[model samples]
Target: MIRTLLMIGLIGFLSLVFLHAPVRAEGEFGGLALGNGQLIFEAQCVGCHVHGGNIIRRGKTLKLKALQRNHRDSVEAIANLVRNGKMPMSAYKDSLTEQEILDVSAYVLNQAQQGWN
Candidate 1:
C-alpha cells in the first residue's frame, strides 16, 4: 500500500538523521579524539607533567584546584595553553597537529578530573 511505502521512507529518513548527523554545537567534543588523547598525553607530556605536576614550574602545576582557580578548566583554554606555551614550556603547535593538541588537552582535563590516575 502507499501508506506502508511512506512509513518505510519515514523510518529510513529518521535513521539517517540519527546516524549521520553532523556535530553543530560547541563543547560537544563527541567527534574529537577521545581515547587517543591518553596515548598522546603519555607519549609527549609525561616527562614534564608526570602525575600532573609541573616539573619546571612547581607552583603552576596541572592540579585540578589550580586549573579551576586559573580558569583553565575547559578544553579550549588548556589546548590554547599547550598550543601557545609559556616560559619553560615549549610550544607543541609546531610538533603536534591541531587534532593532537585537542586530544592531549582532553586527556589532560580527563586525567586531572580523575586525580591524575
Candidate 2:
C-alpha cells in the first residue's frame, strides 16, 4: 500500500511540474512573450470577422475596415473593449487570457497600418 501511494504522489508531482513548465517563445501578446494570440483570434474573432470581409452581427457591421480604424487610436482601447465586451461585441474576458487579447489587438493594428483593404 505504501509503495502504491508513493508512486501516485510521484506521478502527480511530475505532472504538475510539466504543466507549470514555461512555454517557449512564440510571439508577443500585449507586453507578454510566449503568447498564444493567433490561436485565440482564430478561435474567437474569425467567426464573425472573416478575412477582410463584412459580416453583420447584432445589427452592427463587423468589417475589418472598422476594426482597423478602431485599432488606430489605441491598442489598449482595443484590448479593453475586447476584455469588457463593447456593445454589439461579446465580452471575451471569460474566453481569452489578457495576453491573448493584447496579441489580437496587435494583429489588428498591424493589419490596419498595412491598409488591409
Candidate 3:
C-alpha cells in the first residue's frame, strides 16, 4: 500500500512538471528566443494567418514563395508589416511589444521555411 501511494505521488509530480512546462524549439534568431514565438502566433496571428496562409488575401501569405514574391522575405520586412498595418490587415504594434513582434516574425519566417508542416 505504501509503495502504491509513493508510485502514484511520483507519477503525479512528473505529470505536473511535464504538462505545465513551456515548449521550446532548437535554436534562436538574432539573439532572440524562439519558443514564445509559437505561443504568440497561436494567440495573436493564428486567426488570420492559419498555417501560414492568409485568410483575407490569397496572394499575400506567410508562405515562403508568397513572401518572397511580395518582397517580404526577411525578418525585418515581416516585422515591419506586422508593426504597421496593411490594407485588410491590422497592425499589432500597439498590442504587441517589439520583442513579441520580432518573435512572431521569426516564427512566421521559420514556418514559411518549413512549409508550415
**Clash number for every model?**
0, 0, 0
Q: Pick out the ten consecutive residues of candidate 2 with the lowest summed lDDT.
A: 26-35
For each candidate in turn, the TM-score is 0.71, 0.55, 0.76
Model 3's C-alpha root-mean-square deviation from the true structure amounts to 6.0
Clashes of 2: 0
Cα-lDDT of candidate 3: 0.85
Sorted by TM-score, highest first, which candidate order results? Answer: 3, 1, 2
Best by TM-score, which number?
3
What lDDT does model 2 reach? 0.61
Tell how far residue 114 is off in model 1, in angstroms.
Answer: 1.3
**In order, what lDDT does every prediction score?**
0.80, 0.61, 0.85
lDDT of 3 at 50: 93
For model 1, residues 1-117, the per-residue Cα lDDT tens digits are 999999999999989655753332234565666566766777788888889998888877788998998889988999999999888888899999998898888777877887987
Candidate 3 TM-score to native = 0.76
RMSD of each: 12.3, 8.6, 6.0
For model 2, residues 1-117, the per-residue Cα lDDT tens digits are 999999999999988755754343433333443224444565677777666343755333334456645553356776887799866678988988877777776665545545544
lDDT string for model 3 (1-117, tens) is 999999999999989756764445556466554567887888888998998988889889899999999999888999999999798898999999998898888888888998999
